[model samples]
Target: MKHKEYRRVVTGHNAEGTAIIESDQMASQMLERPNRPGVRLTNFWLTDQTPAEYDGPTETCTGDFILHPPQHGSVFRCVEFMPEDPEVMARLSSEDGANAFAEMGAGANIVQGGRHPWMHRTDSVDYGIVMNGEIWMLMDNEEDDVLLKAGDVVVQRGTNHAWANRGTEPCTIMFVLIDGVTQAGGGKGIPPR
Candidate 1:
């Protein structure tokens, strides 16, 4: 899959900014390598990762994600996001018990590590896939972290946890941030924040 040639559709929209784009044919035949110039979100850079006291805990889960948008000419997108830079995130990632963080607003890589904190909501739902590589999810009083690779889907409900990229190269993952907070178990039946 060269330049937008694969098949994956991932976009973002919110109060801060609004952007919608896919590896559609329009993008496939007209996209730059390493840097999708004309396309938006060519870069997902985060500015911080700080911990807070509004979060219950994160669960340990792993998986892969191969994206394919609506257009046939669209390209494929893949990448895993393992809390690879835990050391750095340890200082930046949220830990104040907040609901969750919105790295998308900063275009920042949640795995790169930073002072990013949680968003503090009633229920925070994140749905995505493990494009590549593997991640070690850390949880409280949990057995062992879960291992996920390519073509795997993962969901994080109620809990306090982060990620650990135990793989070689960089792992990519796409996520959809749902509003709400943990209710019964961790983030179980919790309502949106």
Candidate 2:
């Protein structure tokens, strides 16, 4: 899928401590993996620690685009989800899902026998907003699903879930993920600090 281009404006302080526009341009880091066809992720920014430092690197989205955020930080990005092909979906197996997660640097997070092959867990509190089109959010429950349209918002705690774009057009969602601690001490991605 062709990911949507978003104009990102970053603000910072100049030499004299005056506010300035650090960067104002279209985000160019669109990640589209063959393992997860019809899905594209565009990372905007990443913070490695709380009370984020303002005098850090201009571009913090370096390195691999893993599914999880930094150990004690946050990640902001947008995802484009195209309608799934039933034929392709039916042919996929549990190992295929694990392999896909592995491609994203999170093989252990994949749910082997979940409701959907793309079902996976993340150790972050995600704030997701449906920016365009519509999609369905599937949880651990097989029968329970939520349909989200433009302007809808979902606060997803560290949980096992998957997204499905049942609509004909592609769905665009912006997500802000903050590292969190789970009841079982910590998750595989983000450890308790």
Candidate 3:
């Protein structure tokens, strides 16, 4: 289940008012799920607030990947899911694996009181681009699952959903999550299914 390494290029303005490449290297902020060994996440960039002009070198963001989005700004990340069999999916949904996933920072009962282990909702509008392979986007009810292929884009509003890659190859998707509030309750939490 080896995946390609992701490279990130960051730019900034130098003190002499010149544009400079702040960083050009592989993304280091990566997390791997122990239970689902093939699940990999790489956080590229995060902004805690609206960005202002920078007069110094790029500062390392100290944000952690929470199940929720940033309160005021956004986060850009990429996820890779290796092809798995039914047995692997069963393991992922197992109680032990689910608990481990929650401990790994997934939202708590974020989707209808945690009825589904991988189904969770965040308080953000997400723009997702399928970078490689194909995957399925499963909604709360599971009736509207959509298959997306490379180059496909999905606008994921604040909703309870999960991603599944049932193909034979790995799937990669880049997502940008922007803070948002649900209109019904004017809160960051989505309504229960």
Candidate 4:
């Protein structure tokens, strides 16, 4: 599989309190899907909180990074999905594929029991920008599935949803997930933190 490289440049303060480039390098982590051929994920950056200042070089993140939603003040990452052919879709719809996907989701600690095969909900607001190709965003309720093309953006709240690529080309999406809390009484209120 061809891997994608993400070059990251980080800035920090110098001794005289002047901003300078702290580090610049290509990201090293590239996660591949076992069940779904051609699917890959590259986590470019992550922060535990809304950082007050640039401390130093970003920490190297290991292991599965997408198991759960971002915590309070946290931000997740960007992932790319390769378009699935009919064979791949059939495999994904089979029992073995379902089990494999479930295991993968478990490793990421995603919430289980979505209506679709990979349906799950997160307690965060996700900003998704389609960088290439076309894909469908499947929701859990009455809203029609949204077909997103390159350059389209979707603001995803805390909702149960899944992504489907019915085209013949790969789709890349950049996502920044911000932590949020669902208001009490199910009124769609995210109260001030």
Candidate 5:
């Protein structure tokens, strides 16, 4: 899939307390995993704390683009998912999935024996907005996949899930992942299914 570069315009207050454009440029922090071919992540911005403070013109996502958000923060990114390839899916292994997640600093998020190799869980509340094309949101149950289209919004709480694009074009979804604690009380882990 050919990824599209999005323009990011950031605004901030100047020394005199007037609003101004901090930075306006194309977002170039695109991450593509070799193991997960055709999947691309374009990170726009990130905040490292809740009630996010405005520290005036700072680059927050200068480091590696990890899957989970910062400890007490949130991440804003757009993920592009290409149409699924049966051969590629068949070739995927648990070790491959583990390696991919490990590279994203979420080794423990991978679901070992789930329905799909890409099925994983995160300890965050994610707001996913389908921007283009369509995708199927697969959960733990095999019979309950939800089909999402452009303009659709899904509030994905911490759950074991994966995305599958079955259409001809690539599916683009903007995601805002915020650090969350499960109601079950564990702090960091998948909630009970």
Candidate 6:
């Protein structure tokens, strides 16, 4: 269950030794907690290094973030890391997102990472559930901001957002998504996605 060299544009760092439990069936469900329903997972694994990948044009990102494509472009996950600076986060979430150029939308979520990190997409709706660690949902739109513990869920839409990892340790989550644009600037790389 250790994955090495896992890289994904949607991910900020890479995970190693992943143990995925593919099944939306009752088996994957934690029926013990009705408040926290079971989740349908596809690719789940483990990793050692977790952080922002500094490969982009900034120094806030580093680590091995990977995205695996199912046969025939089915759908998958993308993880990312943001700096401690809100200003930097804003820049990355804006038209000049230094970390990414992809237009993510629909079927997305925060699977793992820091606490209170901002999540969004330009063309995809997100669905996220915390696997380990803790996080706080910024609550974009007219929703009440909520804190996500070990077992919390979040659903976000295509908009401008950011995340704040307010934990002594790195925060992590498990999310599922599909149908998203992987290009910046109208998905054609013309500038502005």
| Candidate that beats the other on lDDT, 5 or 6, i.e. the better one | 5
Question: Local distance difference test, per candidate?
Answer: 0.36, 0.86, 0.73, 0.66, 0.87, 0.36
Per-residue lDDT of candidate 1, residues 1-193 (tens digit): 1222344343444445656442232222211222111111222211112232112112111121111121121112233342334454454334321212232222221223222332222134456587665666564424645776767887766344455565665555655434333444554353322
The residue-by-residue lDDT of candidate 3 on 47-90, one tens digit each, is 66766334443644455555445677787888898876777566
TM-score top scorer: 5
Instruction: Assess the local accuracy of residue 103 in candidate 2 as a C-alpha lDDT between 0 and 100.
Output: 74
Candidate 2 per-residue lDDT, tens place, 99-192, comes to 9888778888888988888998788899999999999999888677899999999999877899988779999999999988865545443343
Question: What TM-score does candidate 4 reach?
Answer: 0.79
Candidate 5 lands at a TM-score of: 0.93
Q: Once model 2 is optimally superposed onto the true structure by TM-score, how far is the C-alpha of residue 9 displaced, in angstroms?
A: 1.5
RMSD of each: 14.5, 2.9, 3.1, 3.8, 2.4, 15.5
Best-matching candidate per lDDT = 5
State the lDDT at 11 in candidate 5: 85
> Residues 1-193, candidate 6, lDDT per residue (tens digit)?
1112233222233245354332222111111111111211233322222232233331212233223222122223423222244544443323332223222222233312312232443344456676655655554442755666767777654444544554543445555533244356455322323
Runs off by more than 4 Å, candidate 1: 1-122, 142-144, 181-193
- After superposition, the stretches of candidate 6 with alpha carbons farther than 4 Å from their true spots are 1-74, 78-99, 102-119, 141-143, 157-160, 180-193
A best-first ranking of the candidates according to their TM-score comes to 5, 2, 3, 4, 1, 6
Instruction: Estimate TM-scores for all models.
Output: 0.40, 0.91, 0.84, 0.79, 0.93, 0.39
Model 5: how far is 174 from its true place, Å? 0.3
Q: Kindly report which residue stretches of model 3 are placed more than 4 angstroms away from their true locations once superposed.
A: 51-57, 91-98, 109-116, 186-193
lDDT of 5 by residue, 94-158 (tens): 66788888988887888897777788888889999999999999988978899999999999889
Question: 118 in model 5: Cα distance from truth in Å?
Answer: 0.9
What is residue 162's positional error in candidate 5, in angstroms? 0.3
User: Can you write out model 4's per-residue Cα lDDT over 1-193, one digit (the tens) per residue?
Assistant: 2546788777778889998887788877666767656667666666656552347445535556454444655444667777656665653433443454555453232335444455656667889899988988987663778899999999988776778788887788888777777767675743433
**Clash number by candidate, in order:** 72, 0, 0, 2, 0, 55
